[model samples]
Target: MRQWNFRYEDGEWLASTVPPADDNLTAAVETLVVPFGENLQAVESYLESWGRMERENGFNYSLSTPGAVARRVSKESVEICDLYDQFEDTRIPEAEFISLLRALSTAMRRGT
Candidate 1:
């Protein structure tokens, strides 16, 4: 399973899949970062793009933002609640959620 984390720092939103090893870790090994000022617009654009791409590719997944975690559910409406229960202490943000979708889209396009 792939896990992601996001943080707003130095006027930018940084995203990564690697979890911090300890409380002392400051900088994250980011996969991508969009300037903080562009967050709202970027998120909107990415969501629309993802929707169109999914339609064109006949993808059947749906994204759900409930509380802190972002969930990916299939047409059947199944979720990984069991997995989420394991990490009840963690809190994720909407930006990281959208970033995860973007990452998935990119990976799919690359056929990886």
Candidate 2:
């Protein structure tokens, strides 16, 4: 059997190890692995929390999509509340949202 170790780079997938296929993924995992993103229940909780946050932030857009994405994120992995708080300032501007997201994404990587 053959096994492949995957690493994501530049918006694409990369295989670092070309090993014989085996039942085990490997002796160890260098990057972390999770069967699920953030647990469903956690995401739900985050959604509810975000709704309350939206009210305070004045961001009226439907949070349904963001809530869904939150499902893929571990609650403990991200301080979603922090991002929400930043949104409350309004001074960040729409263009800066992407920068904030990038920072938050980096934070997730670090926390994970």
Candidate 3:
């Protein structure tokens, strides 16, 4: 259910930032851990677990910065230092910002 790019010419699954030049995309995913998910998870987990109260407790991670709202993203799959971007606020493409509170609330309040 996830989309990714990779090269399989050699005996190993070579990782690269370059996209394929052909149209013969294959159904091969080198890793199940999603790239987007890594960013989201990093920010979400930090907000949910620890933060100075006002620093978003998972449900809300909106930090008013100089120009835009920045969020702390953390993930094991990615190098913690390189996972976050300063001006990477929720811009352009519309994507849902989910929180652990919302997910847990729904689960716990189900059938009530």
Candidate 4:
């Protein structure tokens, strides 16, 4: 199974399958950084916006800086694709994704 966890390290919160070894931004199957302050709120808002029926049904959510795009594959799953590198793409359950975000938010608060 894909391991999902988050940690507060070096003034940033990192959510990844495995915590990165160093600050060099090593490759991982899936990862996202939850920056402190207002950015954290933005991340939470993005999470909350998922799985909504009001919007267009097949819309893709793009994370520009990370070069990743996400789309809901089903009610329970989401697919993430790396625009720069196809090897990093993955599909995971929406619940797991939300859990990761929630953990990152909690970690950010604790780290602050």
lDDT score of model 1?
0.40
Per residue, candidate 3 scores C-alpha lDDT tens digits across 4-96 of 233333333332323331221111111211221224353355344434633445333333312223343432111111123321222211111
Which of candidates 1 and 2 is the stronger one according to TM-score? 1
The local distance difference test score of each candidate is 0.40, 0.30, 0.27, 0.52
TM-score (all chains, Cα) for each model = 0.35, 0.23, 0.18, 0.61
Range of the 10 consecutive residues with the lowest summed lDDT in candidate 1: 24-33
Q: Could you tell me which residue pairs clash in candidate 3?
A: 42-73, 42-74, 43-73, 47-58
Candidate 2 on 13-91: residue-level lDDT in tens? 2223344422222211111112114234433444456557555655433232321222112222221221222221112
For model 1, residues 34-96, the per-residue Cα lDDT tens digits are 322334545556578556755764534433333222233433222222222333332234354
Rate residue 3 of model 3 by lDDT: 20
Model 2 clash pairs? 1-21, 2-20, 2-21, 3-21
Worst 10 residues of 4 by lDDT: 21-30
- The C-alpha stretches of model 2 lying farther than 4 A from their native spots are 1-91
Candidate number that wins on lDDT, 1 or 2: 1
28-106 per-residue lDDT for model 4 (tens digits): 2233442233366766676666635315555444432253556566666766656655346667676766666576666
TM for candidate 3 is 0.18
Each prediction's Cα RMSD? 12.6, 16.1, 13.6, 5.1
* Candidate 1 displacement at residue 74 in angstroms: 16
Most accurate candidate by lDDT:
4
Clashes of each: 0, 4, 4, 0
Q: List residue ranges in candidate 3 displaced over 4 A.
A: 1-50, 54-56, 71-112
